[model samples]
Target: MLLQLCLLYVTIWLHSVSAQSSSIAKPGCLERCGTQPVPYPFGVGPGCSMERSFEINCNTSFNPPRAFLSILGGEIMGINPTNVRVNMPNLALSTYGQGARILTVVYGLSTTRYTFSDQNWLTAIGCDDMAAVTGLANRSFSGGCVSYCQSAGDSGGVASCPNDSNGFGLGTGCCRTPIPKGTTNLFVNLTDVHRNWRNNKLFSTSYAFVGEMVTSNFSYRLNDLNNATIFLSDNWSAKNTPPVVLDWKIGQQNCDEARRNLTTYACKANSECVNFDTNIVGYLCNCSKGYQGNPYLDPGCQDSDECADNPCDPNADCTNIPGSFICKCRKSYGGDGMKGGSGCTKLPPSTIINVSIDIDYTWASGKTEISSPSDTRPFISDIV
Candidate 1:
């Protein structure tokens, strides 16, 4: 039964691929399966998918359905639903917000992916407070922002003047510094610290997260420690992939270098073979558009047809074309293809001719274009 189900799924996927080849807006555009809109270079349809490392299984059983991006050989991160807003967990703080903390999370990349060759380091933030963040073991960087005020004033509400002066993380409320490049496995600690500030209730609210510079805004709310609402925005990029950015090249190689010896290299038919730019070792395969499967196998990328999935108006008929489908009026129909027409009506012959003749070539074209530019305009105009 499982085998049969798998076969059926493969067959359906192939048909879907073939039907959607022509109308695909972006050649390699990623699609949103459930609530999560797969970003570019990572797609849901066949052949449009990323490497196995980036495959995401979209589960459609939940209320709105959810998608899980796979990592670490199929380990699940979390589910993202379609059209639903996703809020990443925030990095929490302890030690009355004065301590620097680091989160150890894996970013999908190898060691050679950093451009500067120097790994990323920890940056600290505070007022009269200095903290250091670190990654791995030896890689590190340090800097802090200063808070200045004179004679605690009663004008700004309660007795807490220094604390109230700093706004949210917009810069004035707190300070932040940059981490070095290539750093991973982070750790944070306080250095060049002032014990008096730590003891005070105002400075006691100091907090930190991995990517963000400081936790300055509305006095590090104590409840934030229990709530996973803060998160650090880490800058990570993969090499030899879509949305090119400066980074260490992973599986890249020139065609000539790869083609000379095919034993070790694994580029398949219809796929371009390339060498790693940074390491000068290893090769990778990229299947062209309109096809997807195992690039290393005899068959490459297969087409995908979205219409089979019934992603169209229910009342319309889906006619599958090579790489796409044409939504049209069903048999014996007269109205637009969106909603089923009153099946074919026998208009008075006189009326038919009059209707045809009344439509001027230029006028008809202009009206049609103006009314339904992509032919997707909802049924609103009179067709008679």
Candidate 2:
């Protein structure tokens, strides 16, 4: 019966995936729940997924299946299924009946198409206690943040070291540090150095959480260091879906070696095969310019209509070309009004005056002058 139930659940899940995929509509709806808007290259429905790794379940029961990023066993909260957010919970230590102290949490991501923001600000909070936050990325020492406080009264004021101030890290109850980009993992540690934190009785309640640098404000409190709920931000928006950049290659052999197996090399129509840099021997398929979408499949690399979306400047006219777009100035004007480099310049006033017959060139050249054409007969022309 247990096995049957498991199979049933699996079947249901599979059906849900099929339903989601079939529901994809062109320029589909942005996956959103509450205030969070899920970004592109990601979709909520099943067929919308580019790969199985990008699949997400939109649980409708919790007012939008509380966005979660699933891993092997446990799941991290606030991570939008389509977008990934790593959670590094602080390590907590405790003395039998004394309660818990120190909490540590770490987050990691695998190398794939997505790329991380170069820098993230690290924030830390402590009360007469010791705490440190650290991060590592790209096989180098990215950076860290630290916070420490010593006095109960100082818990609410600016933190500074060697003195009893409310602030701990950066001389305040809270301190933040910046991290570099392309970080694949992050680790954090929180500790009680003075052991004096025990005196506050509620000191163990203190805690911390990482978020967009501008989105979090730390309040100094002896009890916050150990409290789980305190670290969760109610207004936090986990909307950043970092881009995953992938470098794909063709067959298993080197470029020179792969060319020998032309029949199976897999370079289709309108595609070119290039040697992979990592092994000089392997090759990869790249669609010709003006073409996009997957290049490995039949009818691959569809033409992208640049003009359909109106990608030109608001005031300019757009011209669609095969696989490309061109911009021109609107009528009534005479300039090559392209965007980006060397835009149109206004015609000289002299040129305008020269083109008008009513204006006298002699007087108009140096001073304000007005003239009437000889062909004008005021009374007869006005009457007619």
Candidate 3:
């Protein structure tokens, strides 16, 4: 009966704690843009987000709905505090172009809190194609990859280009390179590696793009390389674009500097400031340990009731405290009360121990007096 009462109390206390937690988004603003959560400092309307750069547009005209980064116009697939997953357009080049001109695509978010995360790769898919991805940071940086087919004939090794096990474009049908850190503006250039792309009847179109490292964004079959008609249809639609991960922070200032301006600082109570790992001048906010909730909202983070999970041994007593919990062995039980530790065990209350020691010391007489060893014995009980 006592254990049941304790469990009930814990459940009630946890519910209250969770109820006191603040909203992930702003108070009056809509919490979700379609299926994607529009959490601050990213919101869908005016005065909903921290600033213009963080605004998200919920386009309801689409069949289900779509969320887009207002500044970059990139379709948002998912969002968290530190990163956003999006699908940006792909750069398609035709084989008939030859050296006439190089097709290029550019995506810029240089003034916003978002940066191209290294989790994404600049990928090119085609036969006899070369592509280069460039980012403008402290300086102009570029990386390139090429994909080629040794022979276009059906009996050739073109069928073995993409790895059979995982369908990753290794070199024959697809090639990829990592994007540099702190990339805010991206540019991709696609060109025919050889002027004889028109001669290869197997491949008519090639594509270059930057996408997150995931199977949904990159996996392709041998037929995907041969069919130029696929890229011309809905296959290259906005919804079908490759996913890209972007790192985001609250402001273009370090944690120390942002903390000094409490009125304008993004972090609320029970939260801490964290700077971006890269040289990007910005900081992010996170709930402090033992707390959970949106760090960007007021009434900020709330205590996470660890005792609600019944982490202590069944025979032990659990006490909920601010930011932590305590466990103690029940009456007549021994050992630490933690479930993972030396849990409570049955022990007799009358348990005791006797010891003997010899003392050789004198009072003020400046002489050493030997004391009986038996009197120095101490008693210890319930030592499990």
Winning model by lDDT = 3
**Per-residue alpha-carbon lDDT of candidate 3 for residues 297-357, written as tens digits (9 for 90 to 100):** 8889888888989999999989988788899998889888999999999996695777565
TM-scores of all predicted structures: 0.38, 0.49, 0.78
Q: Which stretches of candidate 2 lie over 4 Å from their true place?
A: 1-52, 72-83, 86-97, 110-117, 133-136, 140-144, 155-171, 195-202, 208-210, 215-317, 328-333, 339-384
| 63: Cα error in model 1, Å | 5.2
The 0-to-1 C-alpha lDDT of every candidate, in the order given, reads 0.39, 0.46, 0.74
The residue-by-residue lDDT of candidate 2 on 135-239, one tens digit each, is 544555644444555455564544432222222235545555555454546665555544543444334443444443343343344444445454444322123
Error of 3 at 23 (Å): 1.2
**TM-score order of candidates, top first:** 3, 2, 1
TM-score of 3: 0.78
Number of the candidate with higher TM-score, 1 or 2: 2
Total backbone collisions for each predicted model:
45, 52, 0
> Which residue pairs show collisions in model 3?
none
lDDT of 1: 0.39
